[model samples]
Target: MDINMKKILLLGMGLSSVFLLSACSWIQPLPGAFNVALLEEKDVTGCTKLGTTTSSVLSHVGLYDRDTAAIKKDLILLAKNEAVNMRGDTIVAISPLQDGRMEFAIYDCVK
Candidate 1:
C-alpha cells in the first residue's frame, strides 16, 4: 500500500480503538471500585418518572430509607474489593461515578 494510505489506515484504527475502549468502560466496573445505582434527587420527576439509571434503580429499590442505606453499604463493599461490576440489573446496582453523570446498573461480578 502507498505510504499515505497506510498512514490513514493506522490513524483510523487508532481512533476506533479509543472509542471502543471508552464504550467498554461504561459497561465494565471501574477498576478498584464497586458499582452503585446513584439516584440523585433531581432525577425523579414524579412517582413513576425516572430520569437516569441511578434514579430508576433507587425507585425500583423502593423509597425505603433502610433499604437504600444497605444498598449503599453493599456498593461500597464492592468498590473496596474490586468486585463491584455489573451490567444493568440482576445484582440491581452496579454503577461507578465518573464526571458528574450518575449511572445505575447491576454488579455483574460474573462478567
Candidate 2:
C-alpha cells in the first residue's frame, strides 16, 4: 500500500475506535434509574404490573461489533430508566438480548 493509503487507513481505524468507545458513554442512568431493582419473575410476586419497556442501543459500530457486556449493561440502564418513568421500582427481563434490543417488565413493587 502507498504511504498515503496507509495513513488514511490508520486514521479511519482510529476514528472508528473513538466512535465505538464514545457510543458506550452515550447511555446514562437517569435520575431514580439506579434505585430501580432488577429481579426475577418469581420475586415480583404481588407486585403491580406497570406494563413493559424495551431498550435498544447500537450493537455495532460500522463493521465491528461492540462489546456484549457493554451492550447488555446499557440495555439494563435504559430499561431501568423506562421503569422509573412508569412509576415502577422494579424490572424483570422478559426477553433475551437480540439485535441490540431487550424487553423488560416493569412493576411497582415498593409496597
Best by lDDT: 2
Q: For candidate 1, write residues 19-50 as lDDT tens digits.
A: 44433322334554433333434433232322
Q: How does each model score on TM-score?
A: 0.30, 0.83
RMSD values, in order shown? 15.3, 2.9
lDDT of 2 by residue, 56-109 (tens): 998887766778888888999999999988889999999999999999999999
- In candidate 1, stretches whose alpha carbon ends up further than 4 angstroms from where it belongs are 26-111
- Which stretches of candidate 2 lie above 4 Å from their native place? 1-23
Query: Which numbered prediction scores highest in TM-score against the true structure?
Result: 2
lDDT of 1: 0.38
User: Residue 103 deviation, candidate 1, in Å?
Assistant: 10
